[model samples]
Target: MTDVIEREIKIKLDIDPSQLVRNLEKEGFEYLGEEEQEDVYLNGTVKDFRDTDEALRIRVVNDKVELTYKSPKMGKDSKSREEITVNLDNKESMIKILEKLGYKSSYVLRKRRISFRKGNFTVCVDNVEGLGNFIEIEGIDVKESDLVSFFQDFKGKFHLNGEPITKSYLELMVNKLDNSNPN
Candidate 1:
């Protein structure tokens, strides 16, 4: 298992994903390739993950599967949290184990992500299955202010003028689902 502090910022993209990629390339960000990821979010038996602001999920990318635990968001300006991840060899067995332990699957999020890198930061342009496009700038073991500043600089460089979205994709999906099927 590996643990790290995830500090990042997300911005809703107003332009197309290709345009964003081109813009990033022009700004000296090297394209890092694309991948399709499926994330299955699980809820704890005793505590609701949404209420606790924590996350437990299994992410499947290509042939690899990883189980991840994310702590609640910390800083007000950014989504800074402690993330622990463990790679598993058998996805089905791990899922069954978690289910037997009372962790129930809550939501599934799928997206196509194109990654880019410039310096110490990695930028991802994501096209979610249901949700729209978004740009996420992530830095590991970095100060919250520095990350935020980098996000601001990136936004200005790309002529983007949108408020940063701190909510996770799972939260956004849940909200969309709830709104669509109102009780």
Candidate 2:
């Protein structure tokens, strides 16, 4: 298992995806292909992951599978956290093992992600199944100021005027489900 600090900022995209791709290309971001991803979030029996603000997820992308644990958000501004991930050979077996260990599946988030890279920063345009389109700027082990500045510059250049969303996809999905099925 390898551990890394993941820092990212998410902005809801209001414009067309093709326009965003054009903007990225004009800014010299290299296309990195696209992939369909499914993330299954799990909850521990001993503790509520929502209350603890931590997450355990099993992610499947094409034929690859990974088990990841994300610590609580580190700061108030961005989604910075310690992420530990292990590549797994079998998704079903891993899910069973986690279930046996008292972790139960909570939610599944599916999205189609188109990726682009320009330096240490990787940009992803995501079309979530139930949610709307979003753009995420991710940096690994980067300084907070640098990440923030990069996002600010990118936002200004791309004419992204909306406020950044700080909530995780899981949080957003949960809230959406709760609101839709208020009983």
Best by lDDT: 2
Question: What tens digits encode model 2's per-residue C-alpha lDDT throughout 6-44?
Answer: 998899998998899888988899999999999999999
For candidate 1, the 10 contiguous residues with the lowest summed lDDT are 8-17
| Candidate 2 lDDT for residue 4 | 97
Q: In candidate 2, which residue ranges exceed 4 Å CA deviation? A: none
Q: Spell out the clash pairs found in candidate 2.
A: none
Stretches > 4 Å off in candidate 1: none
TM-scores of the candidates are 0.97, 0.97
Kindly list the per-residue Cα lDDT of model 1 for residues 1-183, writing each as its tens digit: 999999888988898879889888887899899999999999978888889999999999999999999999998888889999999998789889999998998888999999999877899999998998999999888899999989998898888878998888888889999999989
- Per-model C-alpha RMSD: 0.9, 0.9
Candidate 2 overall lDDT versus native: 0.92
lDDT of every predicted structure (CA atoms) = 0.91, 0.92
